[model samples]
Target: MFDKIKNIFKSDKEENNVTHKNAPKEVTVPAHKIGPKSQDDTTTYVIIGASIAGVTAVKTLRELDKGAKIIVISKDENIYSRCMLHHLISGHRTIEGINFVDGDFMEKQNATWIKKATVKEIDPNNKKIKYEKDGKEEELAYDKLLITSGANAFVPPVKNLREAKNVYPLRNIEDAIGIKEQAKYAKNIVIMGAGLVGMDALAGLVEIDGIGNLSLIASEDRILDKQLDVKAAKAYEDKFGQKGVKIYKNRMASEVLIDEDGKVKGINLGNDEIIDCDLLVVSTGVRSNIGLVEGSGIETEKGIKINEKGETNKPDIYAAGDVTGTGIWPLATKQAEVAATNMAGGEAVIEDRFEFKNTMNFLGIPTVSVGFITPPDDTYDILTYTDGDNYKMAVIKDDVLIGFIAQGDISYVGPYTQLVKEKIKVDNLAERVFELGYSDFFKIKEDGQFEW
Candidate 1:
């Protein structure tokens, strides 16, 4: 094991030495060649969590420094698709279809893959972690560390919920596999939390070749209560309703009713409503995995607190992704690369990737939200136009644009959002401003119109 660890470093050192080796075999060799590669040879980047942010950051870091040693430690043996866990539950996608990258590809990067290993403790002083693999425990060291453990599904409060035999969480790949096998004959499928995951599951399940019936229980007044506002949520409700999605809102799951075998039979609501279901999928918001943070001396703000640079209060220990509570995917990955830069180079601050304004989803339902969605009173004016599935709404406060939501008709929202994000003034010509964009804002005073 020690030899292998030494080889990982040796190869890392040889990689740097190979470049200098091409200097010509005829060149005189100094007795003691003092070079950067000779001293402190290993440039290892140990990134915890091989999820979205971690994987993306590793790729970006390799692009930045191809020779760096990347070590990925994850509890799971294979990569799990988090974005499509709902798809797994709804039987839209299979486990094999989601995992694009595998073990063989990682081996090519000079990356060490540790599976089923739990990080027992993070020691910043030694720059190592006391981890347990298989049955034995060991300590691993690194020059730089990135914590991107992602998030976990919330455990709901319901009697017999924890004891239910058939009930399972659709948070991971295994959960999805279990649901697929166990939920085939489920007469009633009760899904809790009707948020994005819930809706995603609904889409996936409704398209399922099998599965009997689906029931959704949302705690809030509307589905996706956190993401969508009242009006927009209502639109989704109406659409899902047409598909036989029974929605029960403003009710909490107080207790889960089980049969004699402790198998899930029904869910009792706090409002004294009993709903029976064979399978239950709870998709509440995730809480950051902070067990590694509790005693690590790292800062915590709901999630692990790190600056835009992914640097923690403790030296050499940085965090990123969902655990960092940045809520910015692109930014978190960028932060990891920046941390790698500072670790490989010198002391530098990692800049925040982007403000928590909004982002561009690759494949989405044409929805765009920036700043505050719903404005207060008439002080914040709203101009909205809706034609069936297409909707665009903009809010203005104090002669300046404040918030906006655009769906379906978002092809023209690109330049408009750029202006808002840059805080450019748009109150001058608020009316008749739907023309491609305004030239006045760009300091284009040619008295001409937009360039199409």
Candidate 2:
């Protein structure tokens, strides 16, 4: 089923073009005066989220159809990179530095932005949306609608957690700021979940001067279990051990302890252990924000269901970003482009080629895992090379390379990714895997042409 879904989005050019590439940089435009108006129709476009996906849709739509009115409504006060929220907490970036687009992006795109606005409902039948802002309800209509509402942090239900103060879930800039302020005097910080968010938070919190004790609790035995193999995960485990970030595996937070003032005091683990801390960060996981379309007759499963063209069950409505339950940044951007292209009367489709590209760096140790890390049993031959902290692994089935993982040393990640997409025969390359280089794979032909 997964292969069939991937094949549906596979384009001829995409199957050949494998190296990691970024979407077009956001175009900076001069600011222009704008004001609110009553309901009026002029081919307006409405996008629910203002993050990467929604913003990219606006940019792509503008390029295809120049004069269409665009309006972006988001509960967030400003547009910031979700991935860079850790940078903000660590003092590596400021609010301005984390802005995904320029200050005049809405003005330049001739788009209206409704900040801190909550979309209460999506009415596909009437082509309208009901939203509330500052205790007032408002209705807006659109010719086309893109649901990029994205995802929200999923905090598990623990006793006293709801009433505990100074507890945060790192999803937006506001969350990061709140954590930063609490970290100022926090001596001990206990974080739940050992996934990407928890580890990144560990890396960022360690940089703060006063944060002395850090404990990361997770239900899994190893970090990044979904992305890394056992040995590769151990390397991170060892590194975090050296950095004084305590890792408690196979444990979940069962209770939240608070002080007399209802402030967070500590956490009680399911393993009968109590971790005393001043601040708590819940980085368990995320759930799609699909509340707006729950009863609007739009099909959804874990997220709003969409095709390769980013079209939902309803006409003139589309969905993308984390709300689609797809992969991370690259896939989100591609989905946005495809959705916007079709919305603007252009033809485009999202290619699944780059969905395999996943990379994460913790305290300067990089891990790049592409394609399936764990393949079907007895179907593929796996080759592994581990020297000290550096590890490289590859998956080959039917004489073709399918997956690659380079943990410590990620220098040849791009070339490996390219090889996977090209699906070149690995009969000759398998024997010479240890001493691999560009020449070993892409050789010069008899006519002086390079076989890429």
- Which predicted model would earn the best lDDT? 2
lDDT of 2 by residue, 122-216 (tens): 99989999999999999999999999999989887789987799899988888999988989888889888887787767777877766768888
Residues 164-207, model 1: lDDT tens digits: 97777666787777777777888898888876666666666766
Top model number, TM-score = 2
Q: Any residue pairs clashing in model 2, and if so which?
A: none
TM-scores, in order shown?
Answer: 0.81, 0.85
TM-score of 2: 0.85
Q: In model 2, what lDDT does residue 78 have? A: 84
Backbone clashes in each candidate structure, one number apiece? 0, 0
TM-score of 1: 0.81
What lDDT does each candidate get?
Answer: 0.64, 0.77
